[model samples]
Target: MTDVTLSVPQLHEWELMRAGAYGRALRYELPGDDPHRPSLLVRDTAPGSTLTLLDTEATPIARVRVDGSRTEPEGTWVGGVVEPLREPATPTFPELRPVETGELVAQATLLLGRRHGRLDGTVIVVDTGDAHAVSQTVRGLRHDQVDLRLLPEPAAAHLEGAARTELLVHLASVVFASTVHVIRGEAPAPGDGLVVLFTGLSGSGKSTVARQLTRRLRAETSQRVTLLDGDQVRSMLSSGLGFSRADRELNVRRIGWVASQIAAHGGIAICAPIAPYDSMRQEVRAMAERVGRFILVHVATPLEVCEARDRKGMYAKARAGEIKEFTGISDPYEEPADADIVIGRDDADAETITDRVYRLVMGGPEPDYAI
Candidate 1:
């Protein structure tokens, strides 16, 4: 495979991964002894599209690239030396220093505004060697009402399909006020795309309702639907978590991160977690609101009915003291004081329940069942 070297002043530590962890190590060459210095060389290995980080010494320390399967970074092949990148000099951003130019662009914009009045005319230019990064930066600035436009690099055009989809989150999270010209047309406005949160007890059929709702949305509408079911997320995103309150909250947060990504990209995220705490659910709601719309659906199936519907024998086990901290049995399932939609345990079919959720997602009239 052919390798092309590109020079870069700095790279975000979270952008590169090593054995499932981020923050790559770097070695300085003889003349470049100042670790705080900004520029470095990147060796782009073709055929696999891997980006290798070479220090001033020209020694390979780390290799990174956007993983096609995930919006987050993955581990890379590399040596063991690590160093921090130099902070960019932004005279305007004294309160909020400019860091690496990427997805968190809007966050930096907000920080700057909070410390130094409203940023009505602040212009932020981002060149991260990727068009998606530029699009995301523009969108983030727009979200903060920052006036800006993207200056696209010729080499960064013609991104792959997966890379394009991955960049949509950045674009969605940032740009809304100003226009950005892309090979694929303009950045989409953060539309009515909502994070529909379904919170209930362990046996409350929350996951089942979410799955049905997802299917209905996919079949009936042209919009994309991503379902983050509790059990499945526990296996993948929250694999190491135990059933403790703190661990459970962390699990919900992980799910929130994924849902936020989906919501930011103008898609519907149906999350069905046995979220027993209202505070944690509120946290997830805030996360979604930063990028798109948020809706909470409380599956109000009673405890007795839920226990009766528990096919996994979880309720029985919890009652027998085998399972500790089981919601509705041992742990408390805090009901939402204010829910957008409440699904009561009645003879209503799955279609009826799904229709109710779809209505809420589409901003339809408030259902009679809402509390």
Candidate 2:
């Protein structure tokens, strides 16, 4: 079978990639990032092929159909939003653009041959999904050179974790970079429990849901559960921190750190923090994923609804200019774009929401909750 590869920039993309792996049952070890902030996968879809987005429990949340030419990403989906691919990716990926490889191949061979004392044997350069273009380049480069075999490496969707990394590194080594001093580590053992992180606006019932979920999990399941409420965390773990974005991120990270530790020991870490940024939420997700499973439950109560539920009158104060840097008022609260489970005030009752969360945690069937 030919291998296929796609660069995953987010947690949802990674998850989708894993789900679409050959046989649909293979596993991969997720990487770790800042425990200081909280955090958070995808797949390559062939033209005319459909890809479904699922949660950690393998429950379908949405579906996307690949459209347009194979080289370009264009799709339409039902149920939720999926980010379109961005060209000229990022600073770390300047070489990952969609230029014609005919010129690139000639340039690469000359440079690589010069550096590595002439290329020989079977050197495979993986070409993401532009296999035809890459293959043409390799064939062009190999003209009459029988001893030098430059093959276009196939898609590598079947490769798991370190193996996938190693292959990609090997591909880079053959063309642009070397894999010297690259240390490959073993995949960590899967933790027995999960860390359910509730992130959203203040008065979103994140704390309430987290506490109630903890209670339900303890009563219904044998897994140990721990609640890390935002108010308590701010007062204890982040007493001196102000409401600046950096400080808020740090506070969220502190909570993530503690939650990760708890999850590592096979305990459910239920955290409800007003984690207002996507980056921090992803940071926390990465931290916990390395040690245990991480589930992002977005208590997606709207700004108006949250304000109405605000018992502290913080929203009113913020509107009156008495409070500063208040999220959803003076400051922005970035919503989770790819949350595992999303609950809102109008969605269902507390009991129903808690039950849904419990089902997801236990790997049971997910309700048809529209993202």
Candidate 3:
């Protein structure tokens, strides 16, 4: 039998089809000239031939029987599930830490009862962004005959055809259940960890504002506060990295990872970096959000204003072609469209700007300071 490897998303799509979520007449298409496309196998395989489907780890997950009797588009296939060897494996997410084992099992048990009506059969639940270790804990625990499965939340939850029909059936049953017990509880308190990221041009006052904010937070709040200044972090954590685009991105990611760790522990991390690319900032946001709250502060100082304030003559060297990949001069800076707070160069004085950010972080008025 021929073998084909499918990505996680593709595997989910295939599983949906196998579960009759797509009608019998519906066919899947694999376009493009890519050799890995399943269309190649469909064209060559004869009717009734079988193909093995492998996951990213090369583990066999299912088998597909080609129905060559059916005609399809130029690059498409009409395949049916011959057998499903095993359930789709969950994607590995190493960066997130595991939740408490007991808490995870309790939550999984509740979800199983609510969704499946019994705790004996296989039950799939959406992952709660915890690390793989937490999911493994569920496997170690014994819950009578229950088999629990964890699936990540789909990027796009909308479904068509039979899938939608199945969802509607589930919802209707849930609504019309004979005994419905509504459990009420207070909203969860905010997480202890907080990541405040400052992004702007090199000569912008982001570093200065970050330093002041760090001092203020340390003095005012009981939470531990750490400042990750770009230059200081470069000299220590990201030492030996160059100014290339790849290296710069790596440096920013490293800073974000460390900040996320601090946030995970219920501390405050203030980061000041000229994160020129929107993609880099988004990556940082994702990392921080998994563990705690993430606040992005964009210091929107104009490029000309920043150049005028460049006392180090770095901008001059970049304009003279002596330096390559400089952020405002050579490389492009993608301004953030999702900044929680934006401070222009002429917005306000440092104290006023610092006070405004402090209030937002505290969710209310600033506390009085001690002499």
TM-score to native of every candidate shown: 0.54, 0.53, 0.59
lDDT of 1 by residue, 316-368 (tens): 99999999999898999889988888885686877788887888777799898
User: Number of the top candidate by TM-score?
Assistant: 3
Backbone Cα, N, C clashes tallied per candidate: 10, 26, 0
Candidate 1 backbone collisions, by pair: 25-81, 25-82, 29-56, 29-57, 136-170, 136-171, 139-174, 139-175, 140-174, 140-175
Give the per-residue lDDT of model 2 (tens digit) for 1-371. Answer: 11122322333233223323112322222223311110112222332444454433334443444332223111211112232232222222233322223122322321121122234433433333222334444564466352232322223333456565554444434333333223222333466857889988988888877888898888987878989999999999999999987789779878997898788677999999999888788878877775678889888888988888889889999999998999988999888887888887475778778878878888887667643
What candidate 1 gets wrong by more than 4 Å, as runs, is 1-192
**C-alpha lDDT (0 to 100) for residue 71 of candidate 3:** 43
Instruction: Give the TM-score comparing model 1 with the true structure, all chains together.
Output: 0.54
Q: Which candidate number maximizes lDDT?
A: 3
Runs in model 2 lying further than 4 Å from the true structure = 1-189, 345-347
Total clashes for model 1: 10
Model 1 deviation from native, Cα RMSD in Å: 14.9
Error of 1 at 61 (Å): 22
| Candidate models: Cα lDDT each | 0.57, 0.57, 0.63
- Give the Å error, residue 7, model 3: 14
